[model samples]
Target: MVAESGNGVHLLYPVDLLNDEANRDLIKGVLGTVAERFDDDDTKLDQSVFNAARITKLYGVVANKGDHIPLAPWRLSRIINAPERNAVVTIEQLRALVPVAPAKLPAAKRRGNYPAFDLLDFLTRLGIGYRQDMHEGRERFKLDHCPFNADHGCGEAAIFQKAGGELGFKCQHASCVDYRWQDVRELLDGPRESRAGRATANGNRPGEQNAATGTAGALRVTYRRVSDVQAQPIRWLWQGRIARGKVSMIAGNPGLGKSQLTASMAAIVSTGGLWPVDRTRCTQGNVIFLSAEDDAADTIRPRLEAVGADLNRVFVLDAVVESYTADGAEVRRAFNLKNDLAKLETLLIEVGDAALIVIDPVTAYLGDCDSHKNAEIRALIAPLSELAARHGVAVVCVSHLNKAGGSDALMRVQGSLAFVAASRAAFLVAKDPAGDGTRRLFVPMKNNIGNDQTGLAFAIESAEVPSAAGHIETSRIKWGAESVTVTADEAMTSQGDPEERSALKDAKQFLIELLKNGALSSKVIRADANGAAHSWRTIERARVALNIQVNRAGFGKGGIWTWRLPHTPPNTAIESIERHTNCAAAYEKSGGLCEEKPKRNEPDWEEF
Candidate 1:
C-alpha cells in the first residue's frame, strides 16, 4: 500500500514477520538494500523508519506542515495505491528483492593525543544550529548548515561520536564527501602545530595526561593493597533480605507472587513506605521498571496504584531508541541486557536518585547469550551488579524456580548457578506449608552479607484503586507476620501440602535419631524408613539436607553403602531439631498467619 504523507510519500511494506529482534534486522536489511538500489535525486527513501516502534502516517489523516497557502499548503494524506486483496508479504518475497547494500562508513581512528572533546558544549560555544540524535551507540548532531559548504543545508550533514568516544564529521553531499572531523575541527578551532611545540608552550610533557585514562600515557592496570582499603558495612534496603547498591533476586514457582513482591518493593521505594518486617521508613526516590511479562497499563500500573505507589516517581523503560533523523524520525527497539547495559547506566544517571529497579523475568532480555552457561551468565550479570553498586540503587530481578522438586533451595533457581552466585542475596517465594494455601512465604535462599532472616508470610489481597472511571480492582500484598520459622528448603518440597511437610519432617527426625549414634547400612536405613511409613524418596531428601556422609564397606558382591551423620555429636544434632520444631509450634499456636499484621510485641525479624 502507498499513501501521501503530506510532506513526503509513504510506502508501507507488509511482511510476514514476528515482532522480534531477528525480524527487525531482516526488515532493516531489506530497507537498506532497496534504498541503495533506488537512489535518485527526485525522491529519497527514509531509512530511519525501519525500527519496529516507528510510527507511520495513517491514511486519511490531515497532515499540516505549514500555513494552508499555495506555497506550502496543508495536505490530506490518503491511500494513493492499494490492492483489492490485502495479502501478507512473505519473507521469501522480500529476500528476493534484497541486494548487497553499500558498506557503512568506516569508524574514525583515534590518535594518541585525542583531547577530551565535548561536542554539545563546543557546538554551543560556536553558536552553531544543530539537532541532537543517536543511532546504535553513537551520538549524532545534524548540523543545520553544513560546515564544509554553507550552501548545502540538506539534512545529510552530521557530527557524531563513535563507541570509543572519538568525534567524526560526515556530509553525504558530493561536494563535501572527502572532508573528515579533523578538517572540521581545524576549521572551528585553529590548525594544530607540532605536538612538542604545543606541549612545551602548555608546560606539559608529551602525553602527560591521557584523556581516557588520566595518566602520563596509556596505563593498562592499577593495583592496590588490602591494607590501603577501609572496610565498609553492607547497606541494607530491606534489612537482611536486600541491600542497597546491590543486585538481588527472588525466585519462585508460578502463581507464587514473585512479580508482585517486586512491585511491592517498588511501591515502598517510591512512596517512602515502611518496610513490613522492621517498620523502618524508606528513603523516597524514583524507581525504574523493565518488565517484559506483565502489561504496564493493566497489570503493573494497577498493582502499583492499588498498593499506594507514587505514580509520578515510577518510570518504566519502554524501548531503546537506536537512531533519530533530523526531521524527527526515530528507530526504536526492545532493550537487551547483553547489548544495552551502557544505555541502562545512562538512564540511571539521568534519573539521579533512583532508589530501586525491577527487571521481571530477566530471561526475556538475555539476547543471544545461552542462559544455561555459567560463564555467559556471569559475564552478563557481573556488570549489572557493578552498575547497581555504582549507582547506589537496589536492583531486584524476578526469576522462576526450576521444576526440580526436592532439590536444594539455592539450586532451584532457574538457569545458571551464577545467577545465585553473582548476587549478594537471593530469596525464594513459596506458599506456606504450615498454613492455609492463601498464605505465601518469602524465605531466604542464600545471603552473603547478612545473617539469615526468619521467613515472612504474606497474602495477596484485592484492592480497589480510584480511577477516572469509578474504580478498578487489583491485587496487592498484605503482609501476614515476620516470625515464621519456615525455610525455603522446607517450603519447596511440600509446597503448601501439610501431609508432605509432615512426612518430610518425620523422615528427617527418623534419620537424625537412627544415624546419630553410628553408621547404618543404606539397605537397613531404607527398610527402617519403609517400616516407619516414610518413603525412600523422603529419606533420601533428609539425607541431603543433613549432609550425611556415605561410606562404602567391603568389596565386590558384599559391598554396601553406609549412612552416618557428619562428625557432630548426637546431642547437638537433636538440640537443633528440637529447637526448630519448638519454634514452629510456637509460631503456629500464636496464629501469626491468620493475623492482618504481625504482633508488635513479638521480636523483630532482625533479632532472629
Candidate 2:
C-alpha cells in the first residue's frame, strides 16, 4: 500500500532484497528521492505487469502451476525471513514487472570479509577512541574526546560510516573550522569518497522496487549482551509491601481506609519513619500524591497531619489540564494515566530526588480507556512503571475492589487482572476480622519479587489535632504490631459457614470468657474481641447464638448501652443490697438507734 502524505510515513523492504548486494548497491542513491515520489501518489503504482505467480498468489493458491497464497502483514515478515532461492529480485528487474510501483528499504556500513567472530576488528585494531552516547533517545557508538579535539578541547568532532565503504568525519566544534571528512579518511586510511548516514546494519539502501512493507520509518535495532546491563538491588519503601523502581498496587473496598493507608505510607516516606515489620527507616524524600477524590486541604492535608507527616515533603497533584478552549476553559482535565503520563513524568523531573508517588484510585486516571481490557490496562500502567524504574522511585497505585463476592480477594480487585499482574507487589487493606474496631490489616495479595511476604496489622483512629482554626479531627494509621499470618483471603473469606473455619469457634470461646465477668459495653467487647484474635463479625454471631441481652440506659447522645447475659444476675450487686437491708433491720430493732428514714431520693444511704 502507498503511504499517504502528511503521515511522515516510509516503507521497509523485505530482508532478502535488503541483504542482496547488487540490489543494495544499485538502489543506494535513488531510494530517498524515489521513495518520496511514490510514497503518497499512485501515478507510479498504476503500472503493474506481473508474472503468472504474482497473479495466482493474489488468490492464495500454491502457485506452483496455479496456487495462491494469502497476503497479510504478519505473514509478510515470515515470508521475508524464509524467501525462495533463485529469483530475480533487483530494482530494475522489479520495475519491469511493476514499472510504476512504490518501494522502500535500508543500508549498512561496509566491513571487509565480514566474519561473525570479529565484526568491529578494524575499529579495535586502530584503537580508535569511541564511546556509547545517547542519540535520538537511544545509545549509539560515536567518537568521543574527538581525535582533532584531544589537543584543542574541541568537543564536536564526530566520526561516522556509510554503507558504500566510506569513512566520514566532521568537526561539530564551532571554533575548529579547518577539520573536514578527508582528515579522518587520511587517518583511518579508508575509502576516499562515499555517501553519508549509517544504514540498517544488514546491508540495504532504503528499498528495492516492490520489496516493500507497510511498517513506516523502519530502522534497525541494536542490542547489548546481558553482561553489559547494569545491576541494581531491589529497594523497598515498606519492606515486603512496596518496592522502588517497580509498580506496586494496593487495593481494597471503598471506606476500608485504602486512601488513608496510602496517606500514612506517604507520611512515613516524607518523614523517614520506621516501617512496621522490620523497623527499617527509609531516607527522607518528597512524596508525589495524585488524588482525585479527597480535598487537599480538608481531607488529605489533615490526614497527613494526623499521621505526623512532614507537610513540606508532601505534594498533592491538584489538576493537570491537557488542553484548553478559547475561553481558557480546561479541555482534558487532570492527570490521566493513559494520556497525561508524559505530563506526570515532567512533574517527576520537576520534583527531583522524589522517592515515592501515590496514584489513589488509579482507575480514575485511565480516562475513557476500558479498564477491563487487559491489553489496554497493561499499556496504561507500563509507561508509569517504566518511569518509576527510570527514576528509582516507588510508585503505588491505589485501586478499589469489585463487588463480585468471590473467594479470591485479589481477583475481586476491580478492572483488568493485569492491574495486579503487572505490579511487582500487590497489597490489600481491609477491616481485620481478628482485629479491634480500630484495626485494619495490610495483606500481601501477591509478591512477585521475594518470599519474605507477611501480613501487617495497623489501626485507624481519629486524632484531634490543634489547628489555627481550632482542633481538627483527622484519621491516621498506627503500625506497631507484630506481623500476622493471615493471608489476603481474610478479607473475602466468608463466615457464612462458620463451621468451615474455627474462627467462629474461637470467637465463641473468647466471648464466653469475656462476657463471663458480666455485661460489658459492645464497643469495649468488640475491641477486646478483635484484640483477642476474634473477628468482630464472628463475635456478633456468637453474641446472637448465646442470646446475650443488650440494655440501654438514659437517652440522647449521653445514653449508654451495655451487654449482659440473660441468665446471670449481678451477684456482687445482690450481696451489697442484702447487707444494707440487714443493717437497716438491725437499726429498726434498736428503736432509738435506728436512723430516721430519709426520702427515697436522699443522697446518703446508711442505717445508723
Q: How many pairs collide in each candidate, listed in order?
A: 0, 19
TM-score per prediction, in order, is: 0.50, 0.47
What TM-score does prediction 1 earn? Answer: 0.50
Query: What lDDT score goes with residue 38 in model 1?
Result: 84
Candidate 2: TM-score?
0.47
CA lDDT of every candidate: 0.73, 0.62
- Estimate the overall C-alpha local distance difference test score of candidate 1: 0.73
- Using TM-score, give the best candidate's number: 1
Candidate 2, residues 1-608: lDDT per residue as tens digits? 22322212223243234534344334433443454356452343211111122231232222232112121112211121323444444566544443343432223434332212222554575465666454322223466555533423333555544322233455655423434445443334322222222345444433322234543333345588999999977887776567889999998877878888888888889999887777889778899999989989778989988888999998888877767899998876666787678888898898887999998888878876656555556667778889999998999889988754334676677776668877888888877776664677788889888553578888777888777898889888777468877778755564124453477677766776665545555655776876787777667767775687787634674444566655555662233234334444555588736454322222221210
Question: Candidate 1: which stretches are off by over 4 Å?
Answer: 1-222, 324-329, 496-608
lDDT of 1 by residue, 1-608 (tens): 77888878877767667767667756666766677678575766765565667676777878774335443467888998986767778888776665456355545533455444566777886666988888544588888877644545757788877443556788886545546676566444543432112443334555566555565543222457999999998877777778889998899988878877888988898988899967888888899999998889888999999888899999999889999989988988889898999999999988889989888888777877755555556778878988998998998888987654343677668776667877888888988876788999988888888756587889999888777777888898988756587777777776635576687788888987776555566766787787888888779878887788887655665555667678755454344344333443455677743232211122122311
